[model samples]
Target: MPASKGSRNAVSSAVQQIVLSPSDADYLDQLIPAIKDAAHSNRTAQLLQGLSQFADNHESEIEGVCNTNHQEFVNSVNQLLQVREGTVRLTSEILDLNQSIQASTEKLAEHKKALVDSRSVRQNIDEAAQALEDCLEVLRLTNHVHDLLATKNHYAALRALDELQNVHLREVPQYKIAEMIQKSVPAIQKLIAEAVMTDLKTWLFRIRETSQFLGEVAFYHTELRRTRQKERAEKDPFFRNFKLNSAMDLVSDETDEFDVLDNDEVQVDFSPLFECLHIHEALGESEKFRAEYAATRRQQKDLLLPTSIRLVGDDEGGSLSALLESIAGFAIVERATMKKAFNLRSTVDVDELWDSMCQSAINLITQSLPDIDDADALLKIKGVIALFIQTMENWGYSVAALDSFLLTLFDKYAELLKQKFSRDFLEIVSADDYMPMPIQTSEEYEKVVNVSWYTPEKEQSDISFPCVLPFSQMYPLCCIDIRNFLNQFYFFSDDHFQHPSVIDETLKKSLDELLAQKVCRLLVDRLSSQYLGQIVQILINLEHFETACVELEQLLLAARSPASAGKSVALNATEEFRSNKKTAEKRIFELVNSKIDDLIETAEYDWMAPAAQTEPSNYIQTLTRYLSNIMSSVLLGLPTEIKELIYFDALSHAATMILALPLSADVPTINRNGVAALALDVQHLSQFVDSLGVPILRENLDELQQTVNLLQSDNSDEYYDVSTRNKKYGRVDPMNGPLLLEKLTQGMQSSGRTDKYTTLSSRFGKK
Candidate 1:
């Protein structure tokens, strides 16, 4: 009735390992009985008929039970199947992993075998290297032996050399070459000795450094020394405070220490590492001495470097410098201590230097002389002066160094200019090189003039020489100062001789005059032989431009007086009341007219008229309208608002004469005073004062003042003087019979007075 040992073992194992909850225990309790009963019933189905019958009698119950048990079994079987499927997959994967492990194990074994084979091969190579090294040693020994044999048995030594050559280590070395070089140049041996000494010094320095390092390490290993050093490093704020800084800060400032762990102290470099630098510095000092030795060898080798000088027999800075040194010695004794530094080649003769310089300067001066029309030469001279200044700068010479030369040159040029401009003017020239000169300005000039003649070298005066050169204005006039050769030729030209001036006087006059003379063919040009037009103009000024009447009276007075000069008269009928030059006339006339208009009160209209007229004499103002007509005539061919007036008979006759004469001739005209003179002539006229009837000179007038108011009278004769007196229009008795007769006869008796002397012809006339 107790469980078997195996079963008990299995149950214990299941409890520990199988992991079933209480629910699984319940399921198994129901499942186990159903399984057993089914097995038993199937086994005894024929034998237990009665039992079977009983079972059949409760078949429904049994069937229900079977159904419940079967369902429970099916559920249990499905869960078991899923668990089995998972176990199968896991087992298959384990089998595959085991196979992979076996294959990897085989490969690892093969690699281990290969590694062993490689190690063996490497060992063989190491043995072979040793053999090769031994062979090289033998060859080196044989070479040494061969070298000894070379002197005694040369042929045998050659045979030994052939054997040595077949080996790997018989190649040439620098030591042998150095030995050969030493035989030729003993200095090479000295160089080798020095190199060996340097290597020895390196080993000695290394030993000293190792001893010092060991001593330092020993001191640090001891507790007391270590504590002291650590204390000192801590106590010194500079090293003690040293701590981690950011990498960025260390990069920005080299002194920043990210980890200042380096144990080296700030002290002079010592031993092998620093000894190498010291050796290099020592060698550098000897390089100058070696260069001299090299120069000597270079002579034997016949080598040349850049910047070398060539000589006839030899070419060397050293040899040439040596020769100069010898010459300096000789010169010192013969010529009293040399004025310059020694050892310079005599490419140029010292004795001839001044002469050469002076001659070159003279040639330059001559070459720089300006031609009649040499622009390029002038540019070249300017370039030379620039070159001189640049040369002075390059030499760093004193201003006084150039002052004397400049003064001499300027004086010579001044003398040349004096000769050049002896008979003409000096033209001031300009240069494109307009930079301010270093030479004295006016202030400096005054300073120089005030300075003592014998000033110290440092205080030498800068004397400014006033210079002359050519100038070109926007326009060239005869007044322009003459230039060189062109001016020389001009001064001797025929026109120049006529004027006895150095320039073309005519060219200086004006383009207006030149053009007018050429165009008008006026009397200004007629004076090629002499000046008749100018004389005539002068005489006209003296005559003061009289009116025809005044001029006539003048001619008459001359005719009448024995004192009146005949030399000035030309019975011109000239009636030259015309203007002289147009500009002269226009300017003077405009100015005079402007002045008169400013003074006159009655000038409501323009002082001149728009057309030619010969009416409105001044007597019309006082006597007649003739003066206005004459003035208007004189202003003919003038500007706008200018005119001349004449009556129909006189104008028609004048027009005919104008047409008759050549169109070129300036027509005659009257003047202002002539009108006055004519009025005077009428009143107190020498030619025309009436003494008896039909005895005076002939005259006529077109217009008169309407003072009488005549048309108002019914009978002109009855209302004349008596009616005027009755009206009492004026102080005079105008209507008396005799007065009336006198008035009526006045119109007839005075030939100059018009018929309508008192007639009212105007729209606003009093009549």
Candidate 2:
């Protein structure tokens, strides 16, 4: 097996050597595989025999193949021989080229050494040339910048300075002239800034000169714009839709019209302003410029106001109008200047300038306010301020500051009116006589009613006047004064506020507080302290005052703004007036009771000695006469309820005093005569009270009458039985029967009739 493997390896080596092409090698490799397969089958001899026969058959083809490969190998050998010859030739050329390159590098080194020796000198010469050119350019530009600054051409001067610094100076930093020019660059910039600012200042001065005309033009333009806008809105479908959908009605009913100013009418030169703005912007100092501009305008506006305020009228209305107009005019000019110069419609700095300008006028107005005392004059000033505010609003300026000022002015006006009304009220009340205001003629009566806020149920027919007037017309003179004051107040408020149905809530609240705290309180205090004797007249006056307060309250309610229409506002003044009326009424009863007390104290009864006819005592007669005098005098004019109350209380109090007299410690004992006198006085009181037509007063005296009857009776039991049968004497106690009988017996014994009283007591058995 080993010999056969060695034989196969030998055959493979021989075949690989003979087979030059890849395809012949592949065919020999296939023949090896077949010989291996034949050897495995023990047919290697047969396979070798077949291979020999195949070689014999293809000998010529094989020889031809050998010849072809040998010829191609010979050709490849010749090609390699040719390549070797070319390489040898190329190597010889490279050697020659290397020699030539070494010679060229030696020459280049000599040239580089020569160039290196002279390069700094050439660079120095070029630098010197550049420096010369740059110095000339710097000097030229510096002179040109100076000339531009001289001519107020700041923008061109700034550009030249920029060229000197960025282009020329950078190239020649070592040059002294360049250094000098660079050092002076800041100074040049400052010069340009100063020149621009100077131009601005001059422009501002020119603006000041033409400020009034400019203001008129601006106002005319604003009005024209507004007119155009309104016309456009009226024609616009979207605006029409908005108008139809909006809840608020149009503010004005008149046609939207304005007088258009001709463009040729006003010619303002804004070149200097524009130049200044451009220079400042180029300098990157726009904020600084704006601040300076605003400050300068503020100073100019402040100078427009007078140092000392002077009133042109009672409220300084005219002077205020003039000051506001000047402020508004200047403000308009400044606004126009801002738009033209800075192209700014509005800025924070500009708004601050306007605020400061308005503040000057506001300060003047505030200073002038304290001296003005009239509400009407304040109203006029308010109208002027309102117009100013409207004008400013139409000019597209904020009226917030002005609106606040108006509110403050309104407060001051309301306060002034309150003070005025309070002063008037005090004057009227101080001069009041607590007497019925006499209306002698129909004309006088009508005038009083008209002035006194006396609203009658119906108009009176024209007729002859009567001497006696109704309660409404019979109020004191102060009522008419109050009415006059109210009329003036309403007129002033109507004029000032200009609202259809409402005044300011703040004003209304202030008025209410003033009426309650000052007016009603003043009247109440005066009536309580000083008018006790004039109670009846005071009641009539209070009634009228209360009615006037109601009218005033209704007016205030009707004048409420729509926003506050549903809100409830309690008028303390109205209730105060009614309270004051009640106070006056209570004062009447107090006066009546006080007089009764005084009359009762003056009475000195003779309880033991008097045995005369059954007539009323001196105290009772005096009290009755006093009551009758009061009923005929002050009480006659009072209302029926009050009159009856006063008279009835007086009589009741008087009867109580007489009844308590006999039981007093001062009157230790009383006899039949004293008892009879007491009974007569009580009867007189009852009859007097009855005559007053008050049954309640008569009923109140029944207790005293019953005690009097018990005192006058001989048999206590019989009297008790008779009085018990009558409800008029029910106030007399049956338990006091024995005590009364014993007192009677003591009185009789004291009068020398002790035995008769003892017999009566025994008969009655102290029942």
Candidate 3:
């Protein structure tokens, strides 16, 4: 292949020289032009030539392509120019930033130098301030040193000290002065001892004289203390802290003949007078005794007064200005008796006079009672008490003493009622008229029962409108008087003693005079026969045993469900109870929070107004409303059951509703209710119970009279009592058992089933 190639190359070399010539190159170029003519001569050639020609004619295409290329080139150049512009801008920014960095560096160096200079200046100021503080401390210490250098002239030494240097001076209290001196300045104790010795030397003789005087003073103090009279001198601690010598020291004085100190060693027997304080107030001679007591008290007061007191040897007519020299002086005795009566000296603290009076009254009532039911007998007993009380007052008994005596009796009777009420199983006795206050309006009455009444003469009745309140109701008023009387003792100095003997004597004399006089005896006889003794005694007894303790509890609890019980129930507001109840006016409106004031104020005492004139149901309902709502509440708040009875109608109505529910409730006469009618038949029973201090119900059960005729026993009949063992407490009482069961069964049938309490059964236990 190489040889052939070489030969061809040799042969082609000659041809190549011919063809490769520059002229040949030019002829070829011309030949290509002639070929173009030939190509035009043939049809095909002509077609090819036409094409070439067309190509020449279509030069716009190539020119267009060239234009396109040029445009692309310009676009690239423009993009490159944009890139170059951005790079130049970036370079200029970098240069500016470098310049700014250099300036910041210079400023930073300046600021650092300034800060260092400022810190140095601040340090210098601090050093100056520290030096000033040190100077002040030095000055303070220097002043303290000056104060410490005290001289024998204590006052001068204090003045020489600098005020600012010794800013504080801590004083030792007297109690610790010795210890403080020993702790801080031991030499001060020696100086104190020397001063004490010097003081002893200067006042030795004077001290002796002073001691003698103090001994006399102390003797008086001893007398005062014995009678609690020292309270006048030593109202504060000043007396105890006094420099006076004690009486014992006075007694030890060396002087036998010329002793200045009083030897008050004579025993003073004040027990005899004090003993009189305990004497009974109602021995028929109460008036005489009270007078004696008053006089004795006045004398004691005058004798014991600081100005009146005289040493036994120093007086006769010397210093003794006799006020009540005799023990029978009225003023002294009266004051003492009054103190005991008024509770200025309480029964517990003063004497048994009050107790004795109470006992006497109780004994009279108990002894005089013909039967528990005989109220007339009770009235008689009351008359006696009134006689005793009034007689004492008339005989110069202190008003306070009389009041106290009455209050004691009232309280004692009230307690008796409570005891009886427990047996009757009554919450309280419900009556319209209480002992001290009576009712005004019959509409206010819910039931009917004869209230404890204080009837004045017909002439006095029209204008007087007098009412009696229960013992409890009267207590506050009485207490006010009693407290006032008692508080009077605060005005008396302890140096005085009150005597009661004169009052006793005066009271006895007065009684004798009254007894001897016919007019007074007639008055007592008339008043006593009607209202005084037996009736009140009986009422107290019946109330206690019949209705006070348990029944009241039930009534109160039932009252809580006002909506169920009936909205007319008088008690509405308990706020007063929680906040402490004030007067009736304030509590009445607030508690009811209704417009009942007009009705209450305008109410009339005409209980028998025809049913035709008034809506019978409405009247009954209104009456019930008055009773349950306001009156019951009033009674509940009071401590005495007797007051509750003041509203006799309300008491009976409520009792009828509660206790006599089993009876026909077809409203009978407007005048009376179930309990009221029962009370009429059993009025005497109250006296029996009162006399025995038992509940009427319990007593009646114990002595059950199968026949109606056997109910009342003669006065001489033997007394009997029933025990819970025979009729267990809460295990149905005989009188109530059958009725209660029947009522319960009826209640269940009438849709009155209860969840809390079970009804009694015939033969079952608690089931």
The prediction achieving the highest lDDT against the true structure is 2
Backbone N/Cα/C clashes per model: 35, 1, 110
Error of 3 at 93 (Å): 99
Per-residue lDDT over 626-676 for candidate 2, one digit per residue giving the tens place of the 0 to 100 score:
888878876776778777776666666776776667766566566877777
lDDT of candidate 1 over 1-767, digit per residue (tens): 54457644433433333223357565345323322332333322221232234334445454565578977545544544554454345335423433454456567779889989989999999976766665655455455544644343333433343344444333332335323422432242234335434553554334333432332322222323224334545677554322222233223335322211123531212333233323333344344433332343223222111122222233222333332222222222111112221221121323233233333433434443432122222232323332333222222222243333443333333334334433232222111121112332555434432331112123334433452111111002112322232243322221101122212222222212221232122222222322222322322221222232244334333433233334343322123323333333333334333333332223122111233234333322431233233334332223322221122223223222222221111312222222222223224221221331222112221110011222222344434455554563333223322232233333233434434434422211422
Q: Give the Cα error of residue 327 in candidate 2, in Å.
A: 2.1
Supply candidate 1's per-residue lDDT for 765. 47
Judge candidate 1 at residue 540 and give its lDDT.
Answer: 27
Tell me the deviation in Å of residue 148 in model 2: 15
**Tens digits of per-residue lDDT for model 3 on 1-767?**
22345544433343333334588467445434333333333232332333344444434454455577867545544553463454345335423443454456568778989989988998998976765565545444434433543323322222322222233222212224323322533243234223333433333323322332432333333333333323423675555322112343233322422311233532222233332322222113345544544444334333333332222233132222121112112222333434545632333422243333334334433442323332222222333334333323322333354344444333333233323322222222222122433535542221112221222233332433333334322222222322232232221211221222222222223222321222112222222223222233223322321232233234433523222343222221122111222222222223232323333333232222222122223323454455444434444434344333333323322333323323334322222222233333233333333443324333332222221112122210111124532433333235553433333334443344443224233233433
- The CA lDDT at 545 in model 2 is 66
Q: What lDDT would each prediction earn against the true structure? A: 0.32, 0.65, 0.33
Best by TM-score: 2
